[model samples]
Target: MKKLAKACLLITAVLFAAPKVHAQISIGVTISANVAPPALPVYVQPACPTDGYLWVPGYWAYDNDSEDYYWVPGVWVAPPTPGYLWTPAYWGYAGGVYGFHAGYWGRHVGFYGGINYGYGYGGVGFGGGAWSGNTFRYNTAVVNVNTTVVHNTYVDKTVIVNNNVTVNNHNSFNGPGGVTAQPRPEEMAAMKEQHVPATSQQQSHERTASQDKSQFASVNHGKPNNAAMNKVGGSHFTPNGQKAPRNNNNNANNNAANNGHQNNDAAKQPNVQQDGHANNNAMKTTDAEKQDQQPAQQQQHVQQQQHNQQQQHVQQQQHNQQQQHSQQQHKQPQQQHKSAPKPHTEQKHEK
Candidate 1:
């Protein structure tokens, strides 16, 4: 009965808390109810698949029509800009309405309802890691980092308190009996600095999670089977509405094995062993394969004819050279005989 009264007071608080443009603004709000949102479910965080990607923890998103809270799985996303860190959105109780503050990418971390989103997001500020220019340094003490892939890493235990928000409670909102964390000085300053919205990858991941029936609080009762993913849009639903891995290496392996077996069987055939040459007509090709090779065969034949013509031209030139040499030799001998005879006959006549 006391819990019921407290829930009613919490709802009343949401109804009365004054609006702040400083708080997230929206046109038409619906998810707020007299009841508190479901408790945060416990799930293992998937290891960081690769670096330069920050982890966005999973959260419950409300659907007004069904009044159901859908679990958006945690995913690693590449930031829009270098040295920017992601501050996750959270549901806080305000104005008697549980409004959601959308997350953003900024130079520094902002207030996220002091919700203890583990892995460096320790309810106050992000202790997971920090960035140096385009290079992001991960806090090994907190984040589930893969060191082999991401080398620019550091281990730090130092923590700074930027938000004076009340702690030691699991309340999912800011109204009565919920989190009373007001944005501290640094968080407020961080908000004023340049801010970037969530990346397309993260938006797509949330959309996919929203469509999965198994991710709803009403369906899972607080725990989702798939709590995290290595990358955004990793989970796929087929056209038949069944969740299945897009690329199944096992199926591909089976197909390759089947093809190998078929090849072995074909090799044992007599016609194949003879390569269709038994009747001098073996190695018959398909009509399409033959058609594909016709142009190549024609090119090869043309090249061979060109080579033969070149050889013939060289042989003809050699033959002409030999005939010219023989004619020259015959003319030289005739000239020599004529010169010797003339000299001997003139001497005899004189005597």
Candidate 2:
């Protein structure tokens, strides 16, 4: 009887431990850090790469080796099986530690800690699209789709306006000081359903993100350069919704070279203008000096002409005086001669 009671107790304990172990395995809790994750980065969702692909919103994933958080960029991926929807991973605070809960795929969207991932996540359920029979239809008002490529799309803005979807806040975790939300009834029901772990492609995509330094929150400061991708390995996009160039380094170098050339040209233009201005100023100064000296030159010429005229007048006056003196002397001599001859002739006449 004693052996049987021990055996029963052992069986009960095993039965109780089995579900807890299974729950841990399903949730895939790897690490719990002392710090909280950074806020979710705001970025535009890339267009669905092809039909049947769903949008997996970006999240902050913790890395134990580096002791930092890295952003797993949002991507459009095909489901592991038909009718499976992706429930995004989120950080949750418990027991004074922030724990990471890995995401999985299930028939319905489950609890995502009300993180307001945006792009139709809306903090409650996925309003981006729905599985219609086997073909996934997109809500154009919430998600981006190329109508030319993807034909099964519809516009529904009511999901955004009417629903109490909390999108303004960017809190990254759930608990105190973060998103304080309890899972809704539907979310609780969905959580009990069968779940499939992340596919190999999703795992590889995260691994790739973990290696890139730019995706780390400490380095990027919550703004990662590569925020989204069209597919797992397809085109990368920036935070501003611009496509990330494959040759980003080369493009930057080219831009720098072009800017340098432009700056050199601009610098040269100012120097040329200054030189021309200086030459004009020099010419103006020469003209001004010539204008100032013209009157002095004219005055000196007039003084020289007046001196020559005065000298000519003096010479003429001296010639006139000498001629007058010679005439007077000749006349005096004639008078003397006449007087002496007349005295001698008169004495002869009287006798």
- Give the C-alpha lDDT of model 1: 0.66
lDDT digits (tens) for residues 1-351 of candidate 1: 543554565456545556642243231122454456776655455667688989887777865445567777777888898888888777776545566667888888887877776667767678878888888888876676778899888877664233311123445555456666777788777867888888888887776666565666766787666667767866533222235454333232222232321232233354665334643344344566798899999999999999999999999999999999999999998887774444444444554
Tell me the whole-model lDDT of each prediction, alpha carbons only: 0.66, 0.74
**How does model 1 score by TM-score?**
0.58
Report lDDT (Cα) of residue 236, candidate 2: 94
RMSD in angstroms, all models? 14.7, 24.9
What's the lDDT for residue 34 in model 2? 67
Candidate 2 — which pairs collide?
A: none
Error of 1 at 198 (Å): 1.3
